[model samples]
Target: MVIAIGFEGSANKIGIGIIRDGEVLANVRKTYITPPGSGFLPKETAEHHRNQVLGLIREALDVSKIYPNEIDVVCYTKGPGMAPPLLAVAIVARTIAQLWNKPILGVNHCIGHIEMGRLITGAQNPTVLYVSGGNTQVIAYSNKRYRIFGETIDIAIGNCLDRFARVIKISNDPSPGYNIEQLAKKGKKYYTLPYAVKGMDVSFSGILSEIGRKALPQKATKKRKLDQEDVNELPSHEDLCYSLQETIFAMLVEITERAMAHCGSNEVLIVGGVGCNERLQEMMGIMCEERGAKLFATDERFCIDNGIMIAHAGYEMFRTGTRMKWNDATITQRFRTDEVEINWEVGKV
Candidate 1:
């Protein structure tokens, strides 16, 4: 019966959410979108969070119909995100916790996605594919940690898409990745790009570099063909988007299947911002079907960075005797998934 309010601003998005036990009472979010051909920077993103967080918190409280005294705890993302934005949101969370006289818990950004995915989809002990702007990982529960079986060796999948959007001046209104996904839907041709996967690890820098060349004007790109194939001029941006999605998603599916096989798990759960793409879900669903397994997932509401996830993950830790003092609550820019101990029940979660 514990009530928790979570704050999240790990990247361009800022969100406030309130939950009672496992039921979501309020979930609200706002994004700090930059102009076309540009991505959000850490300082500006932090400023946006500082400006919007209090208002969003008020909105969450209003929607939840809960008094400040009723809140059992305040939760915020601790690390593995941009520094400035994470600090801004963490400060707000700590401030609110102090004012409310409640316990403050610092939750891992990646585990927030995994715990929220489990809560929303009701898929216990499934292999997790966490794809976000800042992270790309294939993980599963083993020995009480969300063990990383495979991850990006260089740039993350979402970061790769975001940078590519800047090349073609794609809209960043909803998101660069979302716009790219929409354009990919109308593509009718396939252009080969670099594929980099080694054992269980994958890399996106090569793929982004390869496709970026094709997306540019002929004069701007070097006169070179990848894989000894003809460097054909791209027909349209739509085709470029389509090919990019197919190539990267295939790499993801391949590694995810390998992890699934290694773990002997029949379920695959997709979590994070990139997980919202319908094409990725469709591809992963196909892979699961071929393996005679189930695929658990959610739409943008749960998949995208949101506060409910932070709160949910925080509660999971707080109830298990985890708490952070205000002075000791620190935000990090590079927290790994395997670093956190999963104290909550695994299959039962």
Candidate 2:
């Protein structure tokens, strides 16, 4: 009965998870609400993390009914996120691990997401479509590593949507994506958006800019104010929403199909924040049905950001003797999934 405590303070969310063996006992999270226009600020996020980590840790431990001294290991997300936030959690976890005479492992964020999908879905050899505010990638497991077959060349899908919402002055109260989806539901995709796909890589800034220009005209002043007024109505919003979802999801389906064709594997798994989108799921389901492939998705628990996945990934790493050197352990904002070297047996597939 190994008690493992996992911490993920990457980007705007702070996650904490407790795992025993392969079971997730408790998962807790805290989100940092960023102001509109300004994105992630490392300094601000770090300050917020410093205050939230202790509380979230205590909550997680209580939920798991595990005492600090009983913990066998403390695992924390090492990188591919904001440096300041990473450092804040790392310092906390490292100190806790040392105090308890327990081993500490530094885990990658992307690998955590990948491993969570594995734990929840029991996917052995599945192609992964990871789309989030920070990342957009199509991955597959091969040779004991999650290989990136295709990804966004510039901005992530979520980022483009968020920026587009901001440009249109949409409400950012609940979530940018949700607001955009709501607006899109009522509006018509009156304008034709660009579909740029260079090989497997995608670019969305062009489409976003184009939409913004039409949604909010510049030189028109009050010339075509009716267009803006019409956009404020529901039908126009729905159409735009439908169009945006259709275009982006279509691109994803196309690339995913290409990856499946290339890898010769029919099983597909979708992960990350955007994976929760109903439209994306429908598109993938329809495409997979046509291609005679299967698409697997994590439920809300494992789909969005959570700490359980971190604990699960950390537990696997610990089991496989994947530990980081004290001095060599460092956080990165650009860690790729394929860079991780795991020792899982290929025959398990």
Q: What lDDT would each prediction earn against the true structure? A: 0.92, 0.80
Please provide, for model 2 over 1-349, each residue's C-alpha lDDT reduced to its tens digit, 9 standing for 90 to 100: 6777888887777889999887889999887876665555889989998898888988998899989888777888887777888888889888888788888888888888888887777776888999888899999877778889999988999889888777666665556776776665666555567988879988888888777776554544655545655545433445666677778888999999999999988788899878878778888999899989888887657776777777878888888777777775567777778888877543244
- Per-model tally of clashing residue pairs: 0, 19
Q: Residue 306 in candidate 2 has what lDDT?
A: 73
| Model 1 lDDT per residue over 1-349, tens place | 8888899989999999899889999999999999999999999999999999989998999999999999999999998899999999999988898888998988899999999999999998999999999899999998888999999999999999999999989899899999999999999999998888999999999898888778765554365534322335445899999999999999999999999999999999999999999999999999999999999999999999999999899888988888776677889788899999988898933
Which residue pairs in candidate 1 collide? none
The model with the greatest lDDT is: 1
Candidate 2 Cα misplacement greater than 4 A, ranges: 35-38, 187-190, 220-235, 346-349
Taking all chains together, each candidate's TM-score versus the true structure is: 0.95, 0.91
Please report the TM-score between candidate 1 and the true structure: 0.95
